[model samples]
Target: MSADEHITQRNSSVSGNDTKGSTEYQTGGIHDFKTQPNESCSFTTLKSNTDEEAAIPLMVGDVHLAEAQELWSTVRDKAVKLRMDRSGLGSQPPMTVHQMFMATVQKFGEYPALRVKKDRTWVTLTYNEYYQHSRAAAKSFMKLGLERFHSVGILGFNSPEWFIADVGCILAGGLSTGIYTTNSPEACQYVADDCKANVLVVENNKQLTKILQVRDQLSYLKAIVQYKGELEQKLANVYTWAEFMKLGENVPDAKLDALINSQSANECCTLIYTSGTTGSPKGVMLSHDNITWTASAAGHMIKLKMAEEEVVSYLPLSHVAAQINDMWISMRIAGVTSFAEPDALKGSLGNTLREVRPTRFLGVPRVWEKMQEAMKAVGKNSSVMKRIISDWAKVIGLQASYNTMNGVSSAPWGFTLANILVFNNVRKALGLDRCRACYTGAAPITKDTLEYFMSLYIPIFELYGMSESTGPHTMSWAEGHRIMSCGKVLNGCKTKIDKPDADGNGEICFWGRHVFMGYLNMPEKTENALDADAWLHSGDLGKHDKDDFLFITGRIKELIITAGGENVPPIPIENALKEKVSIISNVMLVGDKKKFLSMLVTLKCNADDNGDPTDDLTPQVVEFCQQCGVVASKVSEVINKKEPAIYKAIQEGIDHVNAKATSNVQRVQKWTILPQDFSISGGELGPTMKLKRPVVNKMYQEEINKFYSE
Candidate 1:
């Protein structure tokens, strides 16, 4: 087969490294950047020398820091201007999702589209290639007689077909459903039955088996299309991916036109089944316009213009976060967005990364925390070579933290010396040297994690948003982030405080075109979410400074109501604890409707940064506990001493919160603080990382009862 023939013919605009013409732009599998040629033209590397700050005088080149920043600045200005212009178009004006996607693709067609490389061989489906795939997939869906509002399911991890299936469904006027790869027989059955999809696309044997198990339960499924090699797990009545493409290639062009003509901007494009925090998952219906406009607005903030550059995408499709960054942004901006190859996210991430050299990467805070932990692990390890690397990393971290904190990202000559001596090897190993910017959301990340990334020259700016808002609200686009705030509101997005506690923080309501039309069949929910004035009642408490940067405090429902009717934001205390110590993982403030403010503490620190506690831990964890002035229990020396510093802070916070309240609201009683960390898999926190209070209180009924009981 010819080199081009080896490439997967999926959406061209969807992948980040799919350029026109093969030039070793693809790889066979993970750990093979040494083989592929870059599709994007050579942008000069940013240079580094010893004057910046380093143990050894080292010179590093090809990063192109100033050039990258300049490009981003121009894009940012354009995004802001376009958003302001569109702001006048009204909150609910309509346009097709396909139109938004195509417009962007036309703009960035020359850039590499999608880069998927494994082991040795690599394939990039460029913008033109991606476009061909979408057109064909849409045509095939039309030939299959799918009607608008009908449902189609795509089940797998991040991949090219994931977007192909999604776009095909939407372009054919059908609603798309995404299933988590981790779904069990019952979960698969539940989603299939609930969404009532007519066609389902499976990645391979594992996900296909899930469909097979629930085949009896699904009444609406008429077609099961497989995207895998068909080498594993036999199945019947299934259309191979190649056959599906053939159907499209053979279809008359007139029918393809009809498919596009049939689609409406305001119609439901995707039925995103939210990974529910409570109860069974519900399908959050987002219109093409809802998501398209959302992408339009969000794209502007991150400068996701359909420019000639690469963006890395490895987020899960089941959630709104990935859908927006990977699909919606690609659809609206028109650039090559790469997917992390299969289950080999970390490995594939490194390989594909070298191939694509993406400018922007949208990640969850957990990923950032993991990166930070990995660095610290390497730095603090006993290995002689690792320790040497760690010493250099400490220098890089210090410089990065200083720059990120001061917002002076331009490096002096000293930091230049450090990069060559230290940061280059780390950057190459992490495959992050090519990254221009990284946006982290979904949950709160330690400032340390953010600084650690920025120090390595990958600025991982954090943001906050929700599914109802179509994605982000407050995003840290620029440098100099206040230690307290998430970042400023994106351009054209507005915020207001409904009611503030003694602190300026209140339920953060948003007003913008990005806010969705409303909840799909639940009118009451729709009404509650979109208030009379059209401002989205975000239900999240936050405060913004004069500069418009937003600082999220806590959830309104989550505000721990003290015994004296004193309202307290638990997140501040929880977050403050995270910044202050190492051994503590999660700290939940209790004492709502109780005499005094108490907290339940969960331990096992490395869940985010460190892997399993059994596999790895810092020796300093024990020593750091002592330095923080925490003492192990007089009764049990084994208990982590770090627990008390957090416990003491919670007690002190009670006093701080009470100072603003009346006499009745003053805090005065005992506090119960435990020594265990809450977990998501173990059912301590929700997937979004919020404390499952009932779970915490139930599991530690003894600890909780000690303070409140007579």
Candidate 2:
């Protein structure tokens, strides 16, 4: 038999186990999967070359018999309609998320799909079990009176329950919406009411309490399910996760299957609400095809191998990048996804990464910066001999990385020795030893962070997209990536720079099946986003290089026009300042309608137990202060004392950046360092760590006015 056939034969009988009573399966603990490690395992592609034969089983539960099909006929047909070029990807039928899950489980039934750490032991859920559980959850959702096109709002961190609830809602013909964990009770109510949510899935009592506070205001909410904690107080229509899973026992599988079969690839199945940094959050409607096609396209572009990719899930799934990278792409390629702890952002992420040793990782810019800071702190305390060796290795590693990025085959002298001595150890410490592709997106990453990682032989590629475009539109791969550019557009997607200036910068527009089905219930806003021809105007300024690599310049809404009528993009100058001054954590430029530009800067500091930025300086920042001959351990001390050494160092760095400014309007005339760093809890950053410009402006209006007065 062929390799594919061997995989099919192994998994053909796996779904039979689900015929057992629901309680029997539900009662099984973590030990059940552990005992039957090899039971009904598989890894295979489809066998069919024709669309008709393959799609015949796209109905309920017949995914097992279809065998792994080889042809992309259905995909090709859909591609033609979307006007997408269909050269690669062979032949395959378009699939709903449910159909895709079923088909994948049929081939990889016993493969470890979701792994979560409980206490000290690792719990595994095979692909088949994942499907069966999601199906059960779908029935429960139907039992809870979920109406077609209504929403199921999930509020939580990344976990197995979060993933299952999202998929289950889609399978039950309801919109799956993710609400940020940091959202207040009012924000939670707005999302629930706006989507007309029939069900809300909370991670714990913390999230559950938010729903309960506004439950009276939610007209369409029928039930609330808390996945993580016990009920301290009895409330009607609220159930524990275990109790909720059993509610669907009486609901037949055939009924749920019919709903799944009714789903069309072209219709919206998911809702992504924007961060609403400027205004109220608007839901961006994403079709079944948008998720499946974009996942497949992105995976293909990055050359993700089937059943080989492994990733850590920590970023907020409410954001499109995390949803696409951690959930959808894993489903597409049958990759293993391990959930990180709730405190992953605070510091525990490193421990989880070391344990999981994922093959692919995606992080926002802040995550990368944190890693950079941690490593620098360690290096600062290292022995003199080790530091010397590390410095030499880094020089060699950086040269090798630059050469590879430029498509040069030649490596510098002692490159192999350097990797063996320092580069490899550094990667292994960061738990990136197995990571083949590391991605950074959701915000602009500094060149300093990029080059810092590159010196250690890890190239962090950039991804560019928005919720309206269904995650990633342009991707930078390891082989052909530029440091600052967001890389080339994905295959089957077209990018247009609408009305370029003399510098070739313009509003970036997108055209693809990945373009969303317009903002939910907001035609005016939808019309503003999607033009008449269905092209998505991103409202971001960018330009393509001669090699066609896209570089984002700035957001049109964020452009600062000075009193002299000069247009200035704050990002370049902001990035320059941060790069020049290593101690600066965040920077915001202020000069709109003013004579000259000024800035609000924040120092690097530690976060408190509540995730709020504290006055205490971080280790790296403390070391920098010592280097500058200043004795200070707190941001308040440095600012209050106006420490001459620290101030002199910052001023010197500012002068260096000013010397390189392109125009007088772009130069910083004055700047003030804030006492605390910007953070999510402080209301200065969005969920994905994108700066909330208007909020920051208002918070520091006094300081900003002082700059102009002086």
Candidate 3:
């Protein structure tokens, strides 16, 4: 989050273990993408990824292409100015996000743009291929009445077509409304209607089903374009992705090029929906200028404008963070952006990583935590292995940080050997072996998990932001990344703790150019979140340090005040228990309006890698019963009935969970270790991994009973 997060690139005359002019340290550590194998170097043919990105709005200009270019120049200048200030290094004059994308298309055209593995090979799109795809798709959308600033519905996972669809929509001068891929039929119906979309670019059969269910409800829907080939189930007004491409193929190239020429940088680009934590989601309208402002704040402190730099796009695009960073940010600079291949998440996660070898990656805490859990699972059985891994992790992290800061790769030869032998496995597991830098946001992440990863020589920066505030507000670590806090305030973004509690924490309020114009229809909600001064009250509680380091404490709405006047911020404790205990997955801190705060802990599903023979978790439950001195009968009773077991589990897990707690704040006086974990496919966790507290609390009224009786 630091404006000065300048990672030094490795220059010649430096080995993986050489220092700067002296033997002490280099100016900074370098990301060794230079040493990674080319896309073709992999065992199979390079191909495209299947993970669908949230739709990007395409543009078509019947007027003012030249003016758009000027706007691009203005925004580009802003980006360059901020980028230079942050890195303390100069950058080539920055282009508008649009101008940047044009440059990137030319540089890495031959490299894999997005890819997926199938049958034994990688299916991918190089930059040239992606450009062709987008242009053709744009032409097709043009045939469907595409015009500047018209809205379209986009529902899918992260993929090249998603990008292509977005670009096509934009190239044809249309805005896109991105809906969550997992949204239910009703929610999907709600979003499509809310956006007033005329066309919907869908991913596959599942997405099509949701639309099909409410096809009649969407009176404005004129066309449905399927990006994933033909649909297995027929639906009204549906067009296959290939047929649409062919429609664009015959369209005059001069006409298509002319459309591209007319784009305006200030045009309304995308209607991004923020996932509602307390209320129904609202559309956050972002323009080329709005997006340009958001990305420019980081400038090149996070990444310099490098044409050949590869970025992997995997996070939910509906959200502003990933949409701006992965698609808009990368395209603005014309860097090679790859999507994870395969609809299957776990499969694509590992394989796509090795193939893409991206220079920048952005993800939420859940994704990062999963990577950490994966590493711990690989080494948990051996204490000696864990210790060595931990020590080497811290050293390599600092070494990488120091070397990166100094612009050197001077890891001691001894350290490099250990890294290769011990740390590489961990890095490879997270598919981060080729990563340059990463940051987790959308929620607060634990210092322990982050610090654990930092040791692996991967510089994972923690950032805090919101959908309302354009995205990032404050970033921690002026120099060395802070594991405990989101970084200091971004350049040009003013942040202050509006009010503090006894602990010096308050809701973080942010005022910036990146802040929203207002909610589309919900003026009251908009007014509450945005103040008179235009600072977006994040609705998140956090505290700041004397040095101005901002540590996000918890969500203001989620704090549970007990009868005794103790306020429990659930997320920190829930985050603390995540993966620390193999049995627990989703945890909710309850006990509000009660004598003391307690917890309701949910167990994770221990599925096999292939999920062929699903893991039978009875033994683990039995062991938990033994560990906590709770009877297996009581555990079984509470497990089956979500309501019935809360009290016993709360009381029992609390006693046992305490042995692991470091302080009174974390110690659970009572808790119910649930029968099962909140699943990804399940709606228990919002897409962002923040708990749906009200839903969970409602589902287990009886289980919370055990603590009340005592």
lDDT of 2 by residue, 1-710 (tens): 11111112111111111111111011111112222211332322332222112111221222111112211111211111222222222212345787678767987899999999998789999999999899999999999999988999999999999999999999999999999999999999999998889999999989998889999999999999999978888799999999999999999889988888766665568889988878999988887777887887787777788888899999999999999999998987889999999999988999999999999999999999999988988898899999999999889888998999999999999998999999889889999999998999999999999999999999999999999889998899987699899987876566778778888888888766577767777868877886645567899999888888899999999999999999899998889889988899999999999999888999999998767899999888888888888899999999999998888888888888889988766788898989889999889998888999999999999999899887
In model 2, where do residues sit more than 4 Å from their true spots?
1-93
- For candidate 3, the lDDT comes to 0.60
Estimate the TM-score for candidate 3: 0.75
Candidate with better TM-score, 2 vs 3: 2
Candidates by lDDT, descending order: 2, 3, 1
> What TM-score does structure 2 among the candidates reach?
0.89
Q: What is the lDDT of residue 457 in candidate 3?
A: 65
> Each prediction's TM-score against the native?
0.74, 0.89, 0.75
After superposing candidate 1 on the true structure, give the runs of residues whose Cα lies further than 4 Å from its correct spot. Answer: 1-94, 104-110, 143-145, 229-236, 243-251, 304-306, 343-356, 382-426, 451-459, 479-481, 596-600, 605-680, 683-710
Best by lDDT: 2
lDDT of 3 by residue, 27-53 (tens): 122212122211111111111122222
lDDT of candidate 1 vs native? Answer: 0.59
